[model samples]
Target: MDVILFRFGNFPVTVLEAGLALGLFVVVAISVLLIVVLRQSRSRADAEIRASEHTHELEERISELLRTQSEMTGRMQTMAEVFGSRQSDMMRAVNERLDGMGQKLGQTMTDTTKHTNDGLRQLHERLAVIDRAQRTITDLSGQVVELQTILANKQTRGAFGQGRMEAIIQDALPATAFSFQQTLSTGVRPDCVVHLPNGAPPLVIDAKFPLEGYNLIRNAERPEEAKQAQAQFRRDVGKHVQDIRERYLIPGETQDTAFLFVPSESVFAEIHENFEDIIQKAHRARVVFVSPSLLLLSIQVVQSLLKDARMREQAHLIQAEVGKLMDDVNRLDERVRKLQTHFGQTSKDIDQILISTDKITKRGRNIEELDLGSLEELPSSERGNNQPTLLNPALKSVPAGE
Candidate 1:
C-alpha cells in the first residue's frame, strides 16, 4: 500500500501520520454501518405493530360470530320441546275419541241383533197359527160331506118320518097348549093333540109324510121315469090320505068335525096342484087334510084363543101387584119426610159446632199475636242475649232500633 501526506498551515506532517489518518477514515466507515443497521431494526418494529392491530380486529369479529351461533342453538332447542309437547297432547285426545266411538258402535250392533231375532220369532208364531186354521177348515169340510151322504139314504130318511114330523108340528105350536101321539077312546093314536084354555077335548093331527116315492122321483134320470115316479108318488099320497081318514076320522073320538094330516112339504104341494080332488074327498068325509103350513095356521088360531085367556088372568095379577106397589110408595114417601126433618136438625147442629170452633180459633190467634208483640217490645241488647245465634258471627247483629 502507498501513502501520501500533505501539510496545512501550522501543522506537522509525516508518512506514518498519513497512514494513521487513513485508519481513522476506516473507523468512521464502520460507525456509519452501525447507524444503518439500527435504522433497519426500527422499520421492522413498525411493521410488527401494524400486523398486531390487524390481528385484534379479526379477533373481535370472531367473538361476535360465536355469540350469534349460541343464541340460534338455544332458540332451536326451545322450539323442539314446544312442538313435542303439542304432539303428545294431540295423540292423547285422538285416542280418547276413538275409544268412545268403538264402544257406541258395539252397543248399536247388539241392539240390532236382538231386534232381528224378535222379529223372526213373531213371524214363526204367526205361521204356526195359520197352519192350524187350515187344518180345522179341512176337517169341517169332511164332516159336512158325511152328513149329506147320510141324509141321501132310504131307510135313514124313513127313520125321520113320524117323529121328526111331530117335532116340526110341536115347534110351530105353543108348547104348554099342545101334545103329540095322544091315544083316544076309539083305539086311534093321532100325531098331535091340542088342549083348549077351557079344558076342551084335544084336536087331532095325523102325520102323513110320503118320502120314498118323492126320493125316487127326484133320482129318476129319464123324463118318462120321472113322470112314472111322480104318478106313483101321487097315488101314494092319495092312499095315505084315504088311510088317514079310515084310521083316524072318528067323529067325537078325535075332534068334533076336523082332523089334521101332516104330509111332507113337497108332497103336500104336489097333491094340492095335481090331485086337488083327493083333498076334496077328504073334506067330504068330515076330515080336513092339512099340510104343515095349514097346521101351523090352525095352531096360531088356537094360540090366539089361549093367549087372550092368559092375558085376562095376567091383568088381574098385574092390578093386584100395582096396588101393593102403590102402598109401598106411600110408605117410602113418609120415610123420606122423616129423613128431611133429621137432615135439617143435623145441619143446624153442624152450624153451631162450626161457630164454637171459630171462636176458639180466634182466641188462639189473639194469644199468638200478643206473644209476638211482647217479643217486639224487648230491648235490642236483651233480645240479643236471649235469642239463638247463627253459625256466622256477622249474622248475630240485628238492624238498629227494630
Candidate 2:
C-alpha cells in the first residue's frame, strides 16, 4: 500500500518510492548474508581436512608404540627365564652348603660329647682314688689315736715295754735261754732273766721306766719350767736305777750287771744327751739303761755265745764222724784193688785160650787135606793119626772158664 509521508526540506516523498527503496535494502542485505555463509563453509572444510591428517599421524604413532611393546615383552620373557635358572642354581648351591655345614656340625658335636664323657670318667676315677686315700688316712689316724691312749696309762705302758722285750728275746734266742716273769730266791719278781752259757749266773732285765718326767720336760714351754722338769727327770731316773740295783742284784744267783729297758729310743737319746751324770751313776751301780736297739744287740751277743758253747759240746762227735768216714774210704780202696787183680787174671786166661784155638784150627785144616783111599789102606794106628781130632787135648788142660 502507498501512503503519504512527511517531506524533507528539499524533496517531496511518496508511498511508492518508499516501497521500492525498502525492497532494494532487503535484497542487498540478503546478498551480504549469503556471501558470509559461503566463506564460513570453506573454513569448515579446511578445518575438517586438517583434523583428518592429524588423526592419520596419530594412528601411525600408535602402531609403532604397539610394535615396541611386543619387543619389550619378548625381552622380558627371556630375562625372566635367565633369572629363574640363576635362582635355581643359587638354591642348589645354598642347599649343598647347608648340608655340608650340618654334617660338620654333627661330627663336631659327636666329638665334643665323647670328649666330655671321657673327661667325666677320668674325673670320677681320680675322685675315687682320693676317696680311698682319705679312708686310709682316717684308719691310720684312728690307730695312732689308740696308740696314744694306750701310752697314756702307766701300767699299760709298762706292759707294752715288757711285751716288746719279750718279743725281742723270743725272736732272737731259743726258749731254753730265757725266762719271763721269773721269781728269784728273794721273793722278788723280775720281768725277764736270760740264762748265760758255761755256768754263768742269769741276767735280770727290768722294763719299768719313768716316762712322765721326760714328757713333762719335753712339753714345758718356759725355760725355768723346762729346767725344773729336767731336774725331776734326773731324780726319777736315779731312783729307778737305785731300785734296779737293790731289787735285782743277788750275791751269786744273778749277774753282777743288770739291764734297765727303755721303751722309747727318743727317751733314751734324751737321757744320754742331757743327763750324762745319771748315766755315769747308773754305770757305777752296775745298772745299764738299754734302748730297743741296744737290747737287741745284747740279745744277739748272748745268742752268739750260746752257739759257741753248743759247738764246743759237739766237737767230739764231729771228730768221731770224721774218723768213721776215713775208715769207710780205706775199705773202699782195698775192695777196688782186689777187683783190679781179678780183671788182670781174666786177661791172662783169655790169651791162653786164643793160643789153643789157633792150634786146633791148624790141625783141622791138616785133616781136611788127607785122601780117603790112602786112609783106608793104612793100619789102624795110622788111620787114627790121619783122622781129624775134633777136640784138642791142650784145650782140655785149659781152665773151665777159658
Candidate 3:
C-alpha cells in the first residue's frame, strides 16, 4: 500500500509523497494537542467552579458572621442604654435619700443644741437659788425653837390650840363658814363655832384637851403614882366633858353633841388605848372625841356640803347664762345666713361687671387703631358706640362684718 493517496504538482514526486505524510502526521499532532488543550481547559474549568462554590460558601459564612456581630453590637447598645438609665435612677434615688437625711440631721442637731442650752441655763439658775434656800433653812430652825417655847405654857398652849384649829378651819372652809369664840344665848362663849347650811344646829369645837394628866401618867416613876395619875386623867377628862355639855351643848344654840379636840395625836392615842371606858362615858354624855386628823376630815366633809349648797343656790343663775348663750348662737346663725346672701349678690354683680369691663377693653383696643378723620367722616348711624361703660359692683353694694 502507498503512504500517499494524492499529490500536487511538485518538483519531485518523492518529496510530494513525503509532504503528504508530514501533513497527515502534523494533523494527527494537532488533534492530540487540541484534545490535551480541551482536557486541560476542562480541568481548569472544574477547579474554577469548585473555587467559585467555595468562595460563595465563604461569602455566606462571612455574611452570617457580620450579621451576628451587628446583632451583638445592637444588643450591647441596648444593654448600655438600659444600664445607663438604671444607674441614673439609682443615683437620683440615692441623692434624694441623702438630701432627706441631711435635712433630718440638721433639724435634730438644732433641737439638740436648743435643749443643751436650756439645760445649761436651768443648771445655773438652780445653783443661784441654792444660797437663798440655805438661809431660809437657818431661819426655820429658829422658828422651831420659838414654837417649842410657846407649847410649854398653859395659857399659851390653849391659845396655840385655838390658833391651830383656826388655821385648819381656814384651810378647809371659807371665812364666813366658821366663827371664832362665838357667844351663845346662855352667856357662854365657845372656843369655835361652825355655821351649817339649812339652819342646822351650830357645832362647838373645844380646843382644851386633858393632856396634863396624860403627861403625869406617862412621866410617873412609881406604879402607885401612875395609878393616881391615870385616875386624875379620867377625872379631868370627865369634868371637861361635863363642863362642855353644860355650857356649850344648849339645844337651840348648838348641836346636842360637842367635839373635844385632842390637839396631840399621842395623847388621843393613849386615851383611846387605856381609857376605853372613858370614851364610852363621853359617848353616853353626848360628847365626841376627835384627833387633829379626824377634825380636818370632818371639816372637809362640811366644806364639800357647803360647796354643793352654794351650787344649788346659784342654779337659776347658771340656767339663765346658758339660755343667753343659746340665744347668742341663734343670732350668730341668722347673721351668717344674711352674710351668705350678701356674698351671693356680690358674686353675681361682679360677674356682670367683668363682662362690661371685657367689652370696654376690646372697644378701647379697637379705638386705638382707628383714624379720627375717618371716624368723623363716618355717618352717625354707622358710628355705633361699641365702648361699654364699666360699673363697679363694690360701689353699688358693700358687705359689713357681723
Whole-model lDDT per candidate? 0.66, 0.82, 0.79
Q: Which ten residues in a row have the lowest lDDT in candidate 1?
A: 393-402
State how far residue 108 of model 3 sits from its true place (Å): 52
lDDT of 3 at 68: 60
> Of the pair 1 and 3, which is ahead by TM-score?
3
Candidate 1 lDDT over residue span 98-202, tens digit each? 888888888888898899889889988888898888898889889767644644665554444556556665776667887766777767767667777766666
**Top TM-score model:** 2
Per-prediction CA RMSD (Å):
38.9, 24.5, 36.8
Query: Which of the two candidates, 1 or 3, achieves a greater lDDT against the reference?
Result: 3
lDDT by residue (tens digit), candidate 3, 168-275: 888999999889877789988889898888788888999977566776887899999999999998999999998998999998768999988888787788889999
Candidate with top lDDT is 2
lDDT, candidate 3, equals 0.79
lDDT of 2 by residue, 1-402 (tens): 223354768776554455455555645664564465556556788665554564455446545544654555555455556656777887799999999999999999999999999999999999999999999999999988886677778898898899989998999999999999899998999999999999999999999887878878888999999999998988998999999899999989999899999988988898899889999999999999999999999999999999999999899899999999999999999999999999999999999999989877866675565544545565677666745543335434534553
How far in Å is the alpha carbon of 34 misplaced in model 2?
44
Clashing pairs in 3: none
Rank the models by lDDT, top first.
2, 3, 1
Query: Which runs of model 2 end up more than 4 angstroms from their true locations?
Result: 1-105, 196-203, 249-257, 297-315, 371-402
